[model samples]
Target chain A: MQPVYEVHKLSKYYGRIRALDHLDLALAPGKLVGLLGPNGSGKTTLIKIGAGLLTPDQGSVLIGGMAPGPATKAIVSYLPDRMALPTEMTTKDVVSMYSDFFADFDRVKAQEMLRDLHLSDSQRIGSMSKGTQEKVQLCLVMSRAAKLYLLDEPLGGVDPAAREYILSTILRNYSEDSAVLFSTHLISDIEKVLDEVAILRQGKLLLHDSVDHLRQEKGMSVDEFFKEVFRC
Target chain B: MNWNITAGRPVYVQLIEQLELAIVTGEYPPGSRIPAVRELAAEAGVNPNTMQRALQDLESRGLLQSQRTSGRIVSANQDTLHTLRVQRAEVYVADFLRQMHKLGYTQEETLELLQKATFPTVSNTKEES
Candidate 1:
């Protein structure tokens, strides 16, 4: 089977500040991979390249055998690190907007998730708490039946309880034919939900292996290994 | 079923052990259908792939049987279940012995300690009588 996402010797630069340097990675379908690194470790850069927000200076990235383009965009659902939704729009309005824009969007599922979270259609995005906004965005992103999901810091800034809810929502909504790549600094909180882990540092890929193999080989959890590998 | 997953060990290994415990203790019950992989993965807050690996491991061990239409069911064989129970208990016993050895106790000393720990209630009852 073809990999859901692939990158080969990909390189990117920000006016001489290298963000991604000769990085190669691949994600197979039916896996939840944790893209882990510290701040300014090129995690976001790699995700952005995969999402088509930025073009690599060298090499190539393919999503489901096609480069990031309109075709690939249709199958990639990206949730940026910060809020990207229109604040003036109500929760109901956002659902309608997504449904109108993406043919694969499931409005009913989005509404059901919103209702379960006790969020009303009348609630405006600007008025909701930061955590609530994140939840709403997650609902919108996950409501799409996309083949690949690139979530940047989906658990960041949320309280522990909300984090648990978000993690379970992602797990419950995930499709077996699709793959999810979510980047986070909080490794311990999200390690359980990941089948594989890719650790990056200083614009380079450090390690990418199955979580079980890592634990069995090192006799330590992913979080512990991350701390040891990226320790100052 | 509260899954106490710690960071010191592999999550899938823990998953396998807890799932085996659930089946052997009758929490899932013999011959009962288990929840779908996605549902159990959500409940455990782990990825479906990781959960799938654990389930596959159990299926290979003959503790679980997968049906095409009905999903996975715990082993219905009483003999298999009984054997699993014994195997699980033996693991605990081996772990205890290893810990005692770590604490500098020889096999004889460990057996003595086990006897002492097991007979206090009997001796107290005899005294009261």
Candidate 2:
């Protein structure tokens, strides 16, 4: 399989602090890889690089054999942990903006998803609760038929029911041809859906393998292996 | 099917090994219905994904069969189960015999210990200990 996202000796710095150090990764296509790490482990940094939202100071990053550019961004869909929607805009307006910006954005699907969510098109984002706004954000991201899906802390800080809804929506909207990279610390809940995983620690790659293969090789639970390998 | 357990190395293989035992020991006897993913997950207190993976692994090995209506079931033919049991028994017996040798016990003594320890007729099994 061709590596969809390839990086070699990738490094990033924010002023004096080294965010990512000599990171090397080659991701195969058709995978839902969990990026596992605690806070400040560069999970967010790596995701930002992948989403083309941030640039690496050193080394090269490629998406489908191309540098992170407009073409790459067109095929990648990103859903940040926090809601960034304009509070003044209505749900329909958000859909329209996404449709205008991304050619791959399917407005019909977006409208259908909004209908399924039972949220009225006239509902202003500011009028809805934070969790409901998250649902709207999720609906917008999933509306695009992109090759790569970067979901950063999608379930973070959400309530239980919202968490469930978000997870199910993610699963339901996933396409077999596309790859979804979800970065979060909620390993226990999402580990099942993950076909593969890349565990990051202290801004470095620790382990990357199929969930099934890892279990077969380690002969322990992923949770246990994680504890042992990352013992503090 | 869903499992709640964290699926990973050695653990997934261990679950597979255990399921194989059940198949061989008639706990999940040949031609008998096997537990659904949720049922097995709850029984094991594992994530339903783990059970689904285990079932998938079993199906791939051809030791278990799956149907749309009945879900997963034990394979009617016991050939695969029988071979697996023999393979595992060899390793376990080898380990037991090696441990006995390390403890300065002879083969005869090891057999005697096995005979006494696992004797099925010993209904009050752990009481003697």
Q: Which candidate is the best by TM-score?
A: 1
Share of native interface contacts recovered by each model: 0.82, 0.10
Error of 2 at A8 (Å): 1.2
Instruction: Give residue A64's error in model 2 in angstroms.
Output: 1.3
Interface DockQ of each model: 0.65, 0.09
lDDT string, candidate 2, B1-116, tens digits: 22234344334556677787777767878888887665564455443455577789989988889898978888848567678888889989899888889999998887787778
Instruction: Give TM per candidate.
Output: 0.88, 0.67
Query: Model 2 off-target regions past 4 Å?
Result: B1-129
Write model 2 residue lDDT over A1-232, tens digit each, in one string. Answer: 6677888888999887778888898777666788887677788898889898899999999888899999999988999878889999999899999999999999998898789778889999999988789889988998898888889998887777667666666665555567788898777777666778888877788888888788778886566778787778
Residue pairs clashing in model 1 are none
- Give the C-alpha miss distance for residue A116 in model 1, angstroms: 2.5
For A30-142, candidate 1 gives per-residue lDDT tens digits of: 88999998899899999898899999999989999998899998899999999989999999899999999898899989998888777879999999998889889988999
What lDDT does model 1 reach? 0.90
**Model 1 vs truth, CA RMSD:** 4.5
**lDDT of each prediction vs. the true structure?**
0.90, 0.79
Candidate 2 DockQ category? Answer: incorrect
